[model samples]
Target chain A: MSSIVSRNLKIYFRDKSAVFFSLLGILITVGLYFLFLGDTYTDGLADFNHPEIFMAGWIMSGLLSITSVTTTMGAFGTMVQDKEKKIYKDFYCSPIKRSVLTMGYIISSAVVGLIMTAVVLVITVVYLAANEAIVISAMLVVKMILLSALTSLSNTAMALFIVSLINSEKAFSAISGVMSALIGFLTGIYIPVGNLDEGVQMVVKCFPTSHSAVLFRQILMENSLNEGVKSYPAAAQAEALAEVKDVLGVVFKFGETECSAEMSLLILVGALVVFSSLSIFTLNRKKTA
Target chain B: MNKIVQVTSLKKSYKDVHAVKGLDFYVEEGKLFAFLGPNGAGKSTTIDMICTYLRPDSGKILLDGSEVGKNDDEIRRKIGIVFQDSVLDPILTVRENVTIRGSMYGLHGKELKEAVENACEVVGMTDFMKRPYGKLSGGQRRRVDIARALVNTPKILFLDEPTTGLDPQTRVNVWNTISDLQKQNNMTIFLTTHYMEEASDADYVVVIDDGKIAAKGTPAQLKEKYAGNYLYIVPKNKDSLLNTLKKNKITYKQNIDTISIPIVHTVDSLEILDKVRENIDSFEVIKGTMDDAFIGITGKEIRR
Candidate 1:
């Protein structure tokens, strides 16, 4: 299984086009943020004391979620190709257990997700300090890294479940396109939950991936939001922080209850477990031609 | 010789199509066994079950005394398969592709390296091992596929249409490699091929048609039973040849310019040739062929 993992990683990284396209989602998001969305978002928060810093964290958090979704999908392109070309049947002839082969694909995709998300995390921090002129502490960076791992694993499991159903490259490509386009809306990065329809907002709150974005936002914007409202009166600062959290998706509400950080973390862990088991079951049950 | 692979009442179905219908066959140890059939005649279905790639709907498959489904791991460890199409990762170098397959069977370190090297060397691919699989030509790719299959030094090698689409020279090369494995390494080869001439060299041949055994025997036995030996004579005078055959009470088949007479043996052609020497302009004796046997048994030519 380790050898399979190593072989998959080598092939993925060796293909320049595949690696470039794997990161295409993050590149597009960052381009959108740089060319227009950045100013528009900061301008919406014009009255805030530190709009640049807060919006930077918000956009960067969304970028991490996008990385988690797309990189793993790109990694899984190998598995789908193996099936499409009947290469999996060759592997089936060997003594290796079917479940071990499934784990090989799963573990490799997770590794890719983790690595690519870490690269995005670094770029996010650099943008925070260089563009927003905000220097977060080492402790904050550690927390973000930990969150990236959770988000990467959670999203990788979800991608695996979807990929297990696909046998052809065309189907995988279609699923990838749909995933890239819908992820932003699902994570509330393209449209804030408060601005959407109640039905869509309910989906955003219920969606497990949206919780990853919320967790990221909670960590990335913790210092920026506090600093942005530090000059306000004590009572006013509390109200301002709460309002900012709601507006930027740092917190999700189901009716009157605000989802706590613990709940959001639990959701991510739950997504990892539920999706991983589901994917394993689907993969094992599938027979190759 | 001991039976290396045995199937009893094995059956498989694909919805309405019964791909394999209670087929029974056995392959002996260290012998070249050929499984011949027309397209979609359940050749692949049978091989898939024997290779442990698919489960038979009913009946038993035993490999070296181990049941197929019940002891697949132990059985798989002793067998290797070369699929009709290339299955190695095209993006990977030939060495990497073979090495990964080797690792799957638990080969590692120096042992794995030597096995990979030996496999490639056997297929005459040692010089091109570093090249990407996709970069190789069709024939080269076929050789690499063989090398990948040989990496485990399998006791039984199963090749499905191993040379279906290759130039004559390359087909002969692949055939030589397969022959070497059986002769020099003493490996048991179970081959499914569309090329009848290739199956002519097999120790035993089984031809299936419409999901059932059409014929099974040594190549000569099958040809002698289902196919025939014939003598063809182009007559100098058609009327004179007809009179001679009729006067001699020899049964014959007449074509536009030639008459054919079935002969029991090659020497019998001499007797018929002597009788028709005065009336024949040219004459030739044709032995029964594997292709003829295939056509005779299946009632159709082998599909591409």
Candidate 2:
């Protein structure tokens, strides 16, 4: 495992384009956030108390999801390149196990996600502190970083599953693009899901991205459970609180308008495990086929 | 000699086309066996199946007396394949490629390093160890690939058209490297090529034509059986030479300016030589070559 990780790291370091794109994602997210909120701040700090300002932070979190998609796109495309060059044949014929190859690719993708997440987190925290909107605690920062990593794992697994099914690069790009667009639009990354038709909202809610984006928004925009739940209205807020209680069970007491951080984290972790298992199963089946 | 590899009734079809018909052959241990065929003659398909890259539709492959299809991993561990196309990573250096291949065979640390060094030395690639594989010339890249396969110290090696696109000098170099490896390691080699000269040097040769075994024997035996000893003549006046041979009842086969007749007796040779002396420009009495045998047996040109 260490050897695999070291080899992946070495390859990653040699890829200047990959490093540049990672930094590009970070810069784009920071630049867009500051551009929109630059005029609103009195001095150098953001006003997190304002409803519009808080919503803007949520929008920034949704945009960060694009980075997750981009990371997977690059990693999966590299896999295709390896196949074209017959480099995969060398590894396949070796004594190395198939599981190791799958895990190595997934872990390397997760590492890239972690790096991008850290960049976004550091810039957001420093920017928020400078604007005097809110102070971030070390514990909250740790939780946010862990959530980011989980989100990355889930996205990478999804990409791996797609790659296992298809061998052509053009087909991979087309399918991954359609998937990213659908997930992004359904999760309200570009347009608010609540503003859509009632039927559309119902359809979007069934998607994992809808739940994931909601959880991420809760973390980045509102630090407290009460503030997180206040984004919705009476009936929806009550339903969210009930779902949180069901997930928490014996962990925490559920108030009239409150969400549970531990419950959201559990859902993310579960989704990651299921997607990763599916990806591995698909890869094994393809190998025999 | 003990048989090291046996392929029985091996068959593979691609959609509507049968790439490899029911084929059977065996390789003896420590022998250099050559598979000779033209383009699209199923040579690559056979190699691919034996290397476990492609599964056969119906057949049994035994390597060292163990069934290969049933024990693919073990069989693969004992065999190394150098594909017609380059398979080395362009981003990696020659040394890194060798080390990674060695590690794949469960070697590591000092053992892996020494194994990689030995493989490089055999392929004469030690001086270019640190160079990026992509930076090297085509022949150099091919040498790196050979070293990569040898790093595992496999019991059997497969070379698929190993010298196919190389210049004459580079081809000689590659062949020399292969010869040295065979002698130094006592390795069993299975090679495929279209060059008749290349096949002539093998310990055993199998000629495949249209997905079937057209002929199989040592170079000397094949020449003796399919190609009979003959006297060749290139006459200056083709019409007069043909008239004389036909009028004299001389049994001969004519192809353009060349005419060949079987050696029946030395008594008739002086009479025939004198009769054609004025009309003929060149004449030779020599043994038949492998090319002649191929043409005689297959009844088709060995198109590249």
Candidate 3:
């Protein structure tokens, strides 16, 4: 399994195109936020003096959350090619067990996710600092880094489970096509959950990935959110803050019940465990092919 | 039987199609064994079971005295396989490919380097170890695959039509490499090939048709049973040869130029050769080949 893991890592890094293409979704999301929809989203939130920073945190957090997923999906691109070319048959007929091959793919993809997400985090931090938007707190940086690792694991597992169901490059290419185009919107980066209909809002809230968006918004926009509200009188600012939190999924709601940031983190972790178990179980049965 | 591999009552089927039907065969240690059959003869399916890649429906397979499917790792460590298809990562260099495979068997550092060198030496692949796999010719890539399999010094080597797609010259190179490996290491070689001439290199041969073993024997033994030896004589004078044939009571078929006699053994052919010696202008003895034996038993050629 270690050999398989090392080989996958080497293969992924050697293919320059794979590395660049894996981050394409994140790049597209950034492009859309700045050039395509920035003014529209910022113009509506005229109440906040620096709404751009808040939205940047939202988009960057969403990108970090989904990076592990799309990059891992790129990592599994190697496996899909191996299957298509029947190179996997050699490994199958070798002494190595099939479970090893499955595990190797999952672990290496997680590693790929971690590396890509870290690079993106560095870029996000620099961008936030240049704009004088981030709180620049030690605790906030530490929290963001820890959350990046957790989301990387969750996204890798989720990506692997989906990869297990597919056998062809053509099918996976179609999926990646859809993901690059729609993943940002799905994660609430393009359209905030509050602005969408109740049904669409529920999807963004219940979706395991959107949890990362909420956690990020709380940390990255903490200073700006507070400063933006301080200009107004205390009572009106308090009501408005409460309203935005509910609308933007900063605090999740189910009927009268409210979920804290900790609850959302638990959900992401739960998704990681479930998707990983399902991927390993299903792959072990069919990996010999 | 000093067997390296043994299978009894083995059966495998996919849905309604019975791929292998209660097959039985054993490969002796330190000898090349050929599994011969036409296309769809279940040759690969049988290899798959013996290699423990597929589970048999009802049967037993033992490799080097250990049960195959039950102790898969044991069976795996004792054997190395160069598959019929290309299995190398095209983008990686040959050394990288070999090193990764060696790691799987838990060899590293000095041991890995020596094993890699030895394997490449055996297949004459050391010169091209640094080249990208995809850049090499088909024959060179095959040799690299052979090196990968040999790096572990497996006790048994399985070659599933290793030379199927090579040109005539490269095919001979591959066969020579295989023969040299057997001579140096005494490894048991289990091979499947459509080239009937290659079977003559095997110490034993088994013919399968429709998932059943049709015949099994030493190459010489199969020739004796199915493909008869013959003597052909072209006499300068037909009258003299005819008189000798009549007196000897030889059952012979005479074409315009040659008289052919089906003989069972060398002694029989030599006796007839003595009688026709004075009258014959040119005489030749014909020994049966594996191709003849194959056609005699299965009534079809070994190609699709």
Off by over 4 Å in 2: A1-13, A18-56, A63-66, A176-186, A192-205, A223-263, B227-230, B234-244, B253-282
TM-score of chain B of each: 0.94, 0.88, 0.89
RMSD of each: 2.2, 5.6, 3.3
On the 0 to 100 scale, the lDDT of residue B202 in model 1 is 97
Off by over 4 Å in 1: A131-134, A230-237, A287-289
Per-residue lDDT over B203-269 for candidate 2, one digit per residue giving the tens place of the 0 to 100 score: 9999998888999999988887776667789989888998999998998999876998776443446
lDDT by residue (B143-245, candidate 3, tens digit) is 9999998988899999989899899999999999998888878888999988888888889999898999999998888988888788888898998888889
Query: In candidate 3 chain B, what residue range of length 10 has the lowest lDDT sum?
Result: B266-275
**Model 3 Cα lDDT, one tens digit per residue, A1-289:** 7778888988888888877787788888778778978888778777876777776766776777778778888998888888888777667667776677777888899999999999989988888777777857798789989999998898888888888888899998888777767777777777777788878877777888888878877777776677666656877998877777676656767766887889989999999999989987878777554
Per-prediction DockQ: 0.83, 0.43, 0.51
lDDT values of the candidates? 0.88, 0.71, 0.84
Between candidates 1 and 2, the DockQ winner: 1
Model 1 has an lDDT value of 0.88
By the TM-score metric, which is better: model 1 or model 2? 1
Instruction: Kindly report the fnat of each predicted structure, to 2 decimals.
Output: 0.78, 0.38, 0.53
Pairs with backbone N, CA or C atoms under 3 Å apart (clashes), candidate 1: none
Enumerate clash totals for all models, in the order shown. Answer: 0, 4, 0
DockQ of 3: 0.51
**RMSD versus native structure for model 2:** 5.6
| TM-score of candidate 3 on Cα atoms, chains taken together | 0.89
Instruction: Judging by TM-score against the true structure, name the best candidate.
Output: 1
